[model samples]
Target: MVLVGWGEQVFRAGLKGRGCGVDEGLRELAAPFVVPDPSGVAIRTRLKQLTAVDEEVLRRVGAHLGTLASGDLKARCHDGLAHDAEAWATRKRELTPLSSARWAGAITRATHEQWALARRCALAHLQSLQAGVHALRHRLSLPLGQKGSKRAPGGYRSRREWHAKARRLRVLEDRLARERAAWQAGRVHVVRGGKRLARMRHQLPAAQLTELQWRARWEAARWFLRADGESGKRYGNETIRIGPDGEVSIRLPAPLAGLANAPHGRYVLTGRVRFAHRGTEWADRVAVNRAIAYRIHHDPVRGRWYVTASWQTPASPAVPLAAALGHGVIGVDTNADHLATWRLDVHGNPTGNPRRFPYDLSGTTGHRDAQLRHALTRLLHWARTCGVRAIAVEDLDFTAEKTREKHGGRKQFRRLVSGLPTGRLRARLTSMADAMGLTVVAVDPAYTSKWGAQHWQKPLTSKNRRITRHDAASIAIGRRAQGHPLRRRTTPPRAHRSDVHGHRIVQAGGDAPGREGPRRRLPGPRTRSVPPDAERTRATRTPTTVRGVRGEQEWVPDSLLLTD
Candidate 1:
């Protein structure tokens, strides 16, 4: 039997033959690669100290532009597979009279982006449905109560489960067919205010919100106050512009142009926006007339307005893997509730004690994001203090693993896997680490936990220092990123008890002599009762046999008695 440790649980899997070992049937692992630096940077600053008139003007402008955006999105969706550049230009032309040419351009661009995102989501949904149908079909084909192997799930444990699964299979099949048809026809379902928030309208009590608050949030979410940047334009953007002096201004739509307080149909808010983070970069970009997009939005819960500035940066050259790992790395294992981390040396040996940065993933989206960011901040600080150049993490994707038909009754496991912030962690870490000049390396997630538990867990654990499976898995991740095998060293075969076939791989250098020899004897007695020289003394002891006597010789006592 082979024991596999998944998260905190260890499960036993039977091997087909006694000759097989824990390493048998393991999937090939992918090579570790450095996560490239983020190609875009976004900075947010609060828009404060606005007068009542300014707020009214801003609201009217945002609403007007938002209506235009909504109409454009609807038109784009209607075009679907038939959409072309000509159709896109025509939509922009229709909006230009209502909004300015720049505002129309931004709205049309946003519409195209939203439509593309919806298509991508539809494709993903179709793939997920296909996976579910395949899993359900595979399981339903087997006999009821049949056992399964490591690679695939078994039959249902009962007739009731079998019948339910059969029904679910039909449902999935129908959904899959519909999704496939929609994908082919380029039809996508998208909600202006997120689908989740839209549903909360019917469940206001459960959402802990009153009708007014929900309406406010919903409208705020659907508002399109974002404007794309254009090079060689005034202050890098013509629609929504923030001057180098931190003055916020917006080019109003035709209907709201009458509300403009500034020259040239632009409204300048009394509030100044200062981006404490990356302020210098934003100022520099504005001075150079580089393209920088800006967005203005209101948070209903906070009762505040904020402006976000974003711009794309050129992709940095890919650093060689060796250079990235030259100063070693901190391998991080992302869990549902915490991040498990451990530092390793250049040789892939773990250094110091393991550390865990805990964070709560339950609560509102903003709360969860804040918790995750806080945890990651602590982790990055620790890594920086250790002087490591890179952070290693598993490239985990639990998309297919979250299917109900795949895990069956293991609802807890499914939820656990689903709750893991694999994608978010990678994105956040890569972006954060890039600013700090630290590389993020992603390694294949296969067998890291299982092999780490088998090899490094207990050996690193002691009364003073307790190492969990996640900590051990961090070590495995670091080693894999450093191009080392997960196992510390390979053991010799039982018959040889030495490296007779070849030298043991992974731990020692090939140039080391006597690598296969028995361990050197220590300078003390092996046990309390045995002296240090006992073996030597035993070897020199005399033999009791008479060397000159034949095989059947009689006893010499008879001759001795006659002489007496």
Candidate 2:
């Protein structure tokens, strides 16, 4: 009888609705490739020791620019699909009187980016709706309680479920239609202060915030104090310039120019700033007057002001896969709470003990981000210690997996999938690894966990070293990245075993002498015997065959045999 383990059953169940094909319970896997280096870098620092006058000037400038930006965004949205270069120029000209030419340029650029982002988001939503509708229709078409294969989900389990799913299908269809219409019309829904924050306005008590605090946060979030860089300009920025000595100055709007503390209608803060991280790179860029964009924003909860400096870097040449795997790799399996990692050699063999770097993803967003960064820092340090030049990770995207329609009643599983931080982990790890002179290899995430458990889990586990499914998955990931098979090498067939077939495990190379010959005999007793010469004695005195011809043999038959 065939026995199925609980883990395997769970894995098979999870494959439902994954759009798997009929191919031996396997999904198409993408070839592994080295992830390219990040094309941009951003470093942030806080503005400290600001005077009351400085705060007043900053607030005034931010508020004035925020109004202009809001108006520009509104106009851009109104233009919709009909927007063009002439319309963009007209908007910038209108804002130039209220703000400076550079400020107008920044606002227009930001508005265009935000609008484009909204359009992309709308398209994604439409796609998601279409997927939901398709899945619901397929499942509803099947008979109730019908079993599903690994390739697709079956019908609902009961009449109640079927009815409920039928309602959901209609709702999804309606949503899909609306989203498709909006997409075709080039209309997108975007909120300036964020849709989540906008909704929090109705539940201030639930959010544990007073009306005044909410208003402050709202206005702070909407403020636009960003400026793009011009290579020929001072410090590579014209509007918001930070000198080599950390002196920050902003070109105030035309109306707010009267509040300028510095010459040329510019406002210079009493506070200075320094980026603790990537300070040398930032300084190098500033010294040479390379283009660097800057953004000033306020954190209402902390009541602190901060400035971010960002710049684009030239794209690095893609490293060949062979070169990246020369020094082996560290495969990392990202989870909701911790990272499961294993170091592997270039031959795709696990080199060291499996390591787990645990991080708490609870609390605020900043806390979660810090936790992730701290965990990754430890991982990178460990990788460097291992002398590996590449880190392998599954190219995971939980976008389709996180939907309620796809996962159904598995709320916990859905939450776990949604909380894996796949995108953030990839981005952070790629940027960090690039800085550390390491490459990241993203392998197909198709069946890492399942195949790892089946082929690697038990074999690698022992009393002293216990390998979890995630650790096994890390091994599989590393192997996959290195172009190795997931499953272990099969043993030789029974007909190819023992001395008759020469070797039991490995076959000799064709160039090997006597490659097809039987194994050489060893000088020892085959079993518990009288002496080591038993083979010679048996060969010399083992004539047990009786020689009898028909004429010479006596015809002696027993009486009992005759009677029978």
Candidate 3:
């Protein structure tokens, strides 16, 4: 517990406060890494008295945190882009330099992605502005007309009328001219900034520009990054430098560096083997061998430390989704609190009764997550039992559409939308399904409900039991993913219907001269004689089921028979 608390303090200080690095000449600030002894006395040892194993742990923690911080920086840059887009489009405002203080500390330790993230956002914003200017100019260039102007009394019959008409046109023309000038000026300024950036690139080395000058140039010329190609993105040793023998190190900012007490004012950190297990231990093999990076995580409830090492490996070839979709697909219709599921064969025929797995989310986050995990476990087990290879799910996203204002601006609607477990469930499902070797296919959710209810309810139902609307929808989702038609022949054949109604009657038979029946036979060709009522109308346009040419042998309903 003491070691855990000490590690936590060091991690928090480095990530939230002045960031730490892995180098020599360690900073010697009052020792926040100091852990209290069993006697409750604070022990100050500059963290050097700790075993080499513990020191390595601290270093890995710091480096791992720095990488995660880069994610934060990327998010901030993207958010800035979104805010700028809204202001420009809705408020007619132009782009401006972001607050330097907000990004001051982050810029110093920016990763390759962080730099690219900012540059791309700035370029996109400038391009949007240019597009707006072009649209405005096109609107202004239309031939002058009295279409939108109020008609003058007497209509140019007198000097006063003519004067009034001319005056209105002039006023409108002047307003347009002013707008054009403002837009053109903004364009000129942005272009000029791009030229300046180009000049700097020629004058300075890449490293020099990368370190201190790029951010300045980006701010001065809002879209200067357009000149550079993303293929040149730097990673690996450039961003995260690791020495020979797996000695990882990073350069800390001044404030964080001063917190350690190593000689030469540098703080160096490394990876150490904690416990070995048949030469397959985490620190022995995982951390030191082919470790592209590491991630640190803490479980507050367990009070333990965990480091996940990422390794670079050759990509494994995966079977194509079509080939892997072996027997059939399991369609999962995700609702607010339950997953409605059904299975469909390759021919789009429902294989079994649908299932509903209910999960409760009325407690803490951990409790809700547990409930979801249990539900998914059961679902995947069922899929495995049925020998299903692919799971079809509706590609439903409510982030942008499920808004309070859209639902009558009610507070309850807003809360409900916020509480939806779509994101977590989708992520968990994808990961777990992949591990189980099940391919997940996302299908369009358009009209699944209406179409399913209209076409499938009666056919998929029995006299004693009927499938719910959601279960029918699940069937639709699976068929769509497999490229099968949704609607199918549902009504029984005319003869079958007659039999069911207990009103069957033989039709008056017609034996044509060339037809083949007990009474008539043709010499050249023979055809089966049909009753007058049984004979199908050749000109009747009712659609009937036709087999598709695909390997799945889909049943395509006759379009003429099916209503929209």
TM-score of each: 0.83, 0.86, 0.45
Which scores better on TM-score, 1 or 2? 2
| Clashing residue pairs, backbone N/CA/C < 3 A, model 2 | none
Task: Flag the better candidate by TM-score, 2 or 3.
Answer: 2
C-alpha positional error of residue 475 in candidate 1 after TM-score superposition, expressed in Å: 1.0
The candidate that achieves the highest lDDT relative to the unseen native structure = 2
Q: Which window of ten consecutive residues has the lowest lDDT sum in model 1? A: 10-19
Per-candidate Cα lDDT values, in order, are 0.82, 0.83, 0.49
Where in model 1 is the C-alpha error above 4 Å?
1-24, 491-564
lDDT of 1 by residue, 361-440 (tens): 89887898899889989998899899999999877654432467766777776666666666787788889889888999
lDDT digits (tens) for residues 1-564 of candidate 3: 111111122222231122232222334322111111111111111111335654444444344334334343444434442444343232211111221221222232333344445455444444434433333333234344323221110123345544554554565456446545644443212222345566676657753656245554433333110111011222132223233333433333333444444443334444432222122322333334332333333332333334333333344465565765568888777765778889999878888788888898889888999999999989999999999888887665443323211222246545654676766777778767765777777775655665776788778788876787778778877887777877985678877754555532233233544332344333232454554566466443333446422355657779866887
Q: Indicate the residue-level lDDT of 287 in model 3.
A: 36
Ranking according to lDDT, highest score first: 2, 1, 3
In Å, residue 231's CA in model 3 sits off its true spot by 20
Where in model 3 is the C-alpha error above 4 Å? Answer: 1-288, 297-304, 311-318, 410-413, 463-466, 492-564
> Per-residue alpha-carbon lDDT of model 2 for 1-564, expressed as tens digits?
322222223334443335343345455668998888999999999999999898888888888899999999999998899999999999999999999899999999999999999998887677678767877888898999998766567789999999999998988888888888888888889899899999999999999999999999999999889999989778999899999999999888888878887899988888889999999999999999999999999999998999999999998799999999999988887776778899999888898799999899778888989999999999999999989999998766545423577657877665555555667888999999999999999887767777888999999989998878888888888999999999989989777675564453356754466666455454354633344545555443435456422355667768746753
